[model samples]
Target: MGRKLEENLNFGETESLGIAMEKEDDEIYGIKADEMKKEKRKKKKIKGEEENQNLDFSESKKKKKKKLEESQTIEIPEKKKKKRSKAEGSSEEGNGALEILEEKEKKKKKKKGSGDGNSLENGEQKHGKEREEFEANGAVVSGNDTKESRYAALTSFVESGLPDEVLECCKNFRRPSPIQSHAWPFLLDGRDFIGIAATGSGKTLAFGVPALMHILRKENRKTSKRAVPLCLVLSPTRELAQQIADVLCDAGKPCGLKSVCLYGGTSKGPQISALKSGVDIVIGTPGRLKDLIEMGICCLKEVSFVVLDEADRMLDMGFEQEVRSILSQTSSARQMVMFSATWPLAVHQLAQEFMDPNPVKVVVGSEDLAANHDVMQIVEVLEDRARNDRLVALLEKYHNSQRNRVLVFVLYKKEAARVETMLQKKGWKVVSVHGDKAQHDRTKALSLFKEGKCPLMIATDVASRGLDIPDVEVVINYSFPLTAEDYVHRIGRTGRAGKKGVAHTFFMQENKGLAGELVNVLREAGQIVPASLMKFGTHVKKKESKLYGAHFKEIAADAPKSTKITFNNSDDED
Candidate 1:
């Protein structure tokens, strides 16, 4: 029994030892599996990092390639860019002429092709031939072409005899205005010219510069002791004559050219003396000039260039016969240049009589009688009784404003005087100019107004045309003008030298006739037309009713000749 118990104990110990060894082997196998899994994860992570680095390198290369490409392209210099922009601007200013001509040509061609051409192919071929000829003439039909382009080409090839001094003067005076740009070349080429540019558009300089150059270039011209003038400029008014003389003299100062002004208001003795002292250029009004020419003090036989400044105004002032007489006296070989703001039938007749058969017709903007676009037209409808109060209010407002120069226009000289007295009573520094005022007083008033000593000026139509008072901030029409043309000239006083301006017109029910034309002018200028004005555009039709005082009602032809006259009578019958 003792031997059996010992065997059983030995068997139990062996079995327990076997179980413990099995557990130890399982734990070691689990740890080895975990270590292998960690190694695989680390290898995958390293591969992902390499792929991300490759993508980053590729993106950097693309950016560098784009930069290199950009650097390879040519860049325009700043100075060249500015010059190109200037050329483009001039091209735009003069492009209207080319556009109009091409459009007309196109319409003609289209009509020809549609109606009587041989065939579509033949018509197209003909059109192409015409285009080639057109281009060969240096008139490129670009969508962006300009008549100035053709003129520029022609000028380069055709020998423009412009003096270096004149060219230098123009450069220093600033690039040519639209009128000068177009008219200068024609005038410089010694071609007769009829330029229709708006007032204050530098017409003085447009004609003056060319006249000076012509006089300076004359052969064997003595500086002193000359009885006859080389060039003659005829103007409508004394003020305008003086202004023209000043412009010509200033422009010709560089060329050592002498200019003198002759007008009726100033003493004739001084003018006679100036004429005797030998003047290269003579600018004068019709009345004074006619007297001087009749007295044999001034002669036009030597005059090579003649400019009728404000030609339309001269005709309007009944200087037509005088102008004809003067032009008839001038040498037929003289280059006749007429610069008018309007193109009336009379002006056309005058041009046909005096100018070359095919004179250079340079018209900036429209030739129709219209106000300057640079001036903002602000029409205020008011009762006749409210005009005074409104005028005062406007003056008071602008009196304290930074822009102080203001000009007020009236229909009558008496009204101008009354307004001046009233404004003066109101403690405003004001001046008056009219037909009744002496020339000295008129000159004094203009001087004071120009110097800003008198910030406000009241004047009749005498101050309307050819007055160049720079920096005039506003123009006030206290009364309606005699005509649409007059209205244009009045507002043109403020907006000079390409500067912006404002015009305030005091309108009344009596001025209804002007509303139609005024609305058209306002609309064409891209201004804000009042709703009140819109009604007049379609309603009012009478042209003479706005300006002239109401005359006797027109009697029907069949009616009695002595029928009772009802409307207000105009004093013009006297």
Candidate 2:
């Protein structure tokens, strides 16, 4: 009888393992449709780019064109690839994203490079047969009236009655974005999900609120170094990770959850000590994190919840190898979730390889990061390098209101410094963040800007995606982004908390080839198109309102409107 009972126990364990495997397989299934947009070509290549033709991609004609491009969209659950927009430079662009930073700098390399003329942009959503009808007439299926959406109620998840002391940390409004609406539910339930939304859409909260929910709901007994981290959120950049960490720390504080931020650029000794002591959640960039793990100061064995925020950026920045290495450190049964503003090749591939089946895909704003819907994107054509002058004029025009808190972007670090200096000379109190600045300086600059002490922040792509300075009145791109993806995130910096903001870009002559990509980006972000694009050799749709509908309306106006949020200080009065 003892031997028979032992045999029964052994069989039961094997059966349980099989059941778990089956459950995982069942939850992780997906089928990707065609993904690539047609290689943007001259009107000569495609007969139908009717200069100003309002081509709604939700149309069949465009679908037919897309099917001809690459044509393979296999919905995989665990593969990762390089996102194409990581595009580049007259100054020896290393190829896509323009310049692949050499482990060392090539300071001597300088060229008035005319143009490589490659076009990059976000691909439209995979449409089913029903999409064929919508596209034929050039109108998309109206969004399912959110009046019926599961998230119509705002006060449920957003906690109220919070003390002013906690709210004073970040001044967060008590509301969640649409992506947060769905993500919070699954995350709170300990379920993993792939969040497909635009940057600045509050995806941080989707992952953050959920993580906080777990922190709040779960009983937090005093934990030791041996106690595993409850959550591990990985971002690609120090700025982004730190930004997320700051928000999480503020939000979590009210609920009694402690979060430690880890990233490169500053000191690591502090991170080591913090991890050694223990933390409820550890948010960080991959490079610094890999070092901590290698040094044995950070341990992932105890982490059960993992989030890859801006997974596409991680893969694009060549952190896939590092991502895989880190994931390997986590427990096999851990829950993994990835959030990206754009679901490019790299993003989809990572999902296929790292994600389990049935990972709910929440594509907010068409996997374009709500770029086309919420942003008032404008592409102003500039004549050659006169971009600096054009930028000044644009700033002067937009700065007519003293309440404007703005972010200005340039392509190169040197240019960012120059712009900041020029603006400062012109009596604008501006701060800049770039790879060239000491990490501590960068953090201070960001902190100052967030505190409303610095109204205008000059930045390169490094400050583009992850920094969370909200309610910025304007975003000026003195240099056009290499791809539409960057454009999306850049403009997304403004128009946050549901407030209408303006995005003015200097589209140089060399960037004319990216016209399609630019239009697609703006149409997605809900920005109005300038007629200048048509005369300068590009096809675009007739102007229509996407999110706030033209004329700079408040995005957060729907909220019980609050006092004007500005970063300007006493010096601005001078």
Q: Judged by lDDT, which candidate is best?
A: 1
Report the lDDT tens digits of candidate 1 across residue range 1-574. Answer: 2123325445456334433433443353344645644643453344344446445434544654454434322244545544554576654423554566679898775443323111233223222122111222211111112234435532221144566765545555545666776666667778787776667777888888778878777787776556788899999987788778877777777787888998876678988998888888889888888898899998888888999988878988889889998888888899988888765545656776777544555556554446777888998878889999999998877666634899999999899889998887887778898888888899899988888887688999888998888789999999988677898889989878778999999777887877877877777778888887666554545332212435423221111112386998898987
| Candidate 2 lDDT score at position 390 | 79
Q: Please report the candidate that would top TM-score against the real structure.
A: 1
Q: List the candidate 1 regions with Cα displacement exceeding 4 Å.
A: 1-150, 153-161, 401-403, 534-574
**How much lDDT does each candidate structure score?**
0.70, 0.62
Number of clashing residue pairs in every model? 0, 43
lDDT of 2 at 276: 72
- lDDT for model 2 comes to 0.62
Model 2 spans > 4 angstroms off: 1-155, 158-176, 213-228, 254-256, 368-375, 400-403, 425-427, 523-532, 535-574
